[model samples]
Target chain A: DAGITQSPRYKITETGRQVTLMCHQTWSHSYMFWYRQDLGHGLRLIYYSAAADITDKGEVPDGYVVSRSKTENFPLTLESATRSQTSVYFCASSKGVPETGTRGYEQYFGPGTRLTVT
Target chain B: AQSVSQHNHHVILSEAASLELGCNYSYGGTVNLFWYVQYPGQHLQLLLKYFSGDPLVKGIKGFEAEFIKSKFSFNLRKPSVQWSDTAEYFCAVNPYGGSQGNLIFGKGTKLSVKP
Candidate 1:
């Protein structure tokens, strides 16, 4: 109950509609990410936030927008959903990358949101 | 461009059988490698990771992986697997000095262990 979570676990929308997938983590991690899992493509990073008010593009960020107004919340928005945008979206958070002479950190993932665009 | 490769797309095994999944990456310089498992209808969980220490790292659920830097490989192995081990396995890599949250993942291998 204290881990990361995603809202609207399953969603259906028409093309050109707008959809937002919400992610929240109680860990107060400094790094949060959004990834879309697709067949034959695996999981592609779409966006990530280093901390509140700091967001950046990932491998696949053409049609997706993300904002992290709060450290615990990172929401992804599809300005105009397309059929190509329909996929399983996952949110993850991590403390920080291991600095020199420090141990590494692993990410915690959410349940995932399965989005379908018709 | 950096990328991760998982050799198998699907693997079938019987209970108590030995298992190994191959993973490779195409990134120059130092890297962090990880193996993650996803059970049915579940989120991804870290199985093991290799950072800067020993090449052979043991993870949860009797899983272990060896990072062979010369070959750019990290292969997961389990001496004897159970039916409960049936799930999807993913390999990921992050280049050193890159963004902390930038991880390139493999397509994933689905393991089906028959009871």
Candidate 2:
């Protein structure tokens, strides 16, 4: 009730079909992020939004698109899904990287959306 | 580009045994270090973090990590581990701000505790 939640926890879609993963946070954090977790690669950032409309690309953003229309929600879309896009995707949020001189900022993570492409 | 490194890919330990997982980073200037844990089928949770003042930081569930600036290492440790302590741990780093907060994560270490 107090943390971030992701929708379509498990999804099965066909290749070339469009899909969207939803993330919503109750914290109303200024920053929201999307990451995909694969077997060998721990977690790779997809896209992140600093605020409502300021979104930036992250590593491995080739086949994904993101839009942040509101502060609480950041949704990631697969315009035309591919077999390679099947992975467990996670969403995260944090205030900032611990002021400026700090070595830490803790981020809250969502349960993650596991997508399977057929 | 900044990158995080986790040397131990998998570890198995008996109950009541001590535990340590290795983590390293390749970044110049300052550093922000973190250790995150993911129990089977659960989301990643923060174990602890090291900011500035102290190198040794304690986290929930009886875990601690020491940040060594010289070797670029932040290793997680537990004096005595329980069976429930089995999980996948990840080390992450973000070099600085003004840059998009892209977290560089290691390959991860999987710890299996035999009860």
Candidate 2 Cα misplacement greater than 4 A, ranges: none
Report lDDT (Cα) of residue B59, candidate 2: 96
Candidate 1 overall lDDT versus native: 0.92
Q: What is the per-residue lDDT of model 2 for residues B35-60, given as tens digits with 9 covering 90 to 100?
A: 99999999999899877788999999
Residue-level lDDT tens digits of model 2 in A18-78:
9999999998888889999999899999998889999999989999999998999999999
- TM-score of each candidate? 0.96, 0.96
Worst 10 residues of 2 chain B by lDDT: B94-103
Q: Model 1: runs farther than 4 Å from truth?
A: A98-102
Residue A9, model 1: lDDT of: 98
